[model samples]
Target: MIEVIDEFYSAALAQETIRGMIENARGGYRNGGLPVYGYQNVRSTDGNGNQKTRYEINEAEARIVRLIFELYAKGNGLKNILMHLNDHGHRARSGGLWNKATIASIVRNEAYIGWTIFNKKDTKIYGIQFKPRTEWVIIKNTHPPIVAEQLFNRVQALIEERHPTRTAARTTASTYLLSGLMTCDRCGSSYGVTGYGRGKKYAYYNCLTYSKKGKQVCPGHSIRADELDAMVIAKVRERLFSEFNIRQLLNDLNVATRTVKDGRCEQVKDLKRRLADKEARLLRQYEAIESGKIDLSLIGDRLRALKAEQNALREELANFERETMLAPPVITRAIIERYRQEMEQVFIGENVQEQRAFLKNFIEKVVVGESETRIVYYAGGIRIPSGIFPATSEHPRP
Candidate 1:
């Protein structure tokens, strides 16, 4: 505990120091970092008598900023803009000629429009990473505006149109039930939904390796997505997840669990120890806040995280105790029957996510061949159980 407390305070001091500096930087107060081009960092003392830095527009540089926006919006590419700026009497604040990246960055920066942001990124052990915009502290109208908001919006639209991003919309827009489970038998590549139909509304599951690399890599094997999905769902519902199969699987699980009760005491003790540690750490943070050893605002995020961990630990500890002391649920024939009925409704229902879960539970993977498909079951799950499906197009039994 002594060594742990020392290490925690060292980390806490670093966190608190960085957060205090960011809090002081809310209204464009600089922290010795280079200000964006067209803005100069000027030092001044705040009302607290502590010296700080904030951005003020450098007019000579501001004119150059406005010119870049105008030129880009007029259909000028980065190359032309770069050449135009360097050929003329313009250079970076470092007195070096401007490059394409420098020119492009000025056009994209929001600092020119008089809004300053702080805590937009965090530095972890790996490297710098951007925080979500909601977490960023944005102070508007803090400095004099150089370019109009209208110009910035126009430039942004052009930038997005030229270099479009993928999967921003398509990720949620396209959902497949057997996505992770379905694979091609020929090349062992996963089948994913691709292409649009006559009205750009329908898609198909094409072999990923073949679709990406062409027929020279593999055959152009494609299947109508709806047909394959319906067939697989039917097979899973009628064959694999049948009530007889459900009952036998539960019986097997209950028998297996009865023999495995000897190894749980150590797990319970370990969880109790972990739970106690989380509670102690949470208490320390609370004491620090009450005793004035730490600022609440600086430690609020960490405090919430610790409280969440405490809650999760409590839930886990309860589960471990219940499992060790109390018996497992009496999984009777009536209980299995009720579960089977609910599963039937799950497949027939409109909730695709629920249906997907049930399918993944019953079957491990589906290997799609030219003439047939193979459904692999989780072991000890279904009767007629050699532990694998061993079915073809002519005869696919559950």
Candidate 2:
């Protein structure tokens, strides 16, 4: 019991001494006088001397703290910003490496926001250490802010956006050729690429919804990567070489306007009816407001909603009428010739990026069905369908 009391007194004395030294240094620095700097090298008669590491808040070190705070505000998460600093050979305050915990501490420190909190955690005698937020002593405006409060809040928001509590692992790279251009005809969902087995062993593209869950959600429709590639190459070759297929595509596109004209006319009429109904509602709201039948607040809200609906309807009606009246001319032999020449250039292009660009420009989507696969081509402001059978000899080609 006596020894324990002695040790406690010694610790208390040491802490007091350190506090007095820090206060003296701070006062001397404030008064434009030299601080006591030789304490680190002060030797005692005991072992190893008092060789300790001391830190002084020099202008260069302060500048580094400011730089770190600025980086945190610029839409970079703590981990990434720390990595960038470390990569550029920036060392931490203790001349040590940077880690996630250190970066997190720097971000959460209120000192950067021009405030300091002391005694956040405390220990009394031999009892367990305890810290209550309400007991913390906060000193406001203790230091200059390195980043604005608004910018810091935005950085926090971005951090939360990137790291949600529950998130699925992002699998594929964004540069896949068929990424947004393929769909399942049965479920009308997009197809996704998946890999199987271990490293360099196996990989394939399957219906994403089915692969992640089960076949009950979707029938497991899949095509081998190599097989799909070959099919697309063959189709491209055939389309380029075969004169008959090229002519048929052009003729079909030409005839589409005449065949869909009646349907287009009905669509325009329907849009006009919708526009008239919306306009009638808007006029009714105006009359109610004019006569003071409704409160001004309620009338204003209703008027705004009605006006928006009427504007949308008017826009739709105008679009329908324009499309009906100004349909592109029917695909002709000359048009076919020009398309063939363009396609040939794409087919024989040495650059992969150019080929993918051409394919994306012409093809909207390729829908894979159980029995038939349909390629939707974007031509003359319409999606022209080209049918292919997976069971048959014909393969996919762009």
Give the top-scoring candidate (lDDT). Answer: 1
Residue 257 error, candidate 1, Å:
6.7
> Best candidate, TM-score-wise?
1
Measured with C-alpha atoms, the lDDT of residue 334 in candidate 2 is: 85
Q: In candidate 2, residue 385 scores what lDDT?
A: 24
**Count of backbone collisions within predicted model 2:** 4
Query: Cα-based RMSD of the predictions, in order?
Result: 20.4, 21.9
The CA lDDT of each predicted structure is 0.71, 0.58
lDDT of 2: 0.58
lDDT of 1 at 387: 24
Model 1 whole-model lDDT (C-alpha atoms)? 0.71
Candidate 2 lDDT by residue in tens digits, 1-398: 99999999999997887565445333221212332211111212213453333223445555556666677666555545555666677666667655556665556566555454556657674643537868765555533555566655666665556553645444452334456667877777887565432342333455655443334446646554444544555565565458787767877886786878878899888888887888888777777878989676866777788888878878887887888888667777887788778877776565556666766766677677665555666642222122332222211110
Quote the positional error of residue 254 for candidate 2 in Å. Answer: 15
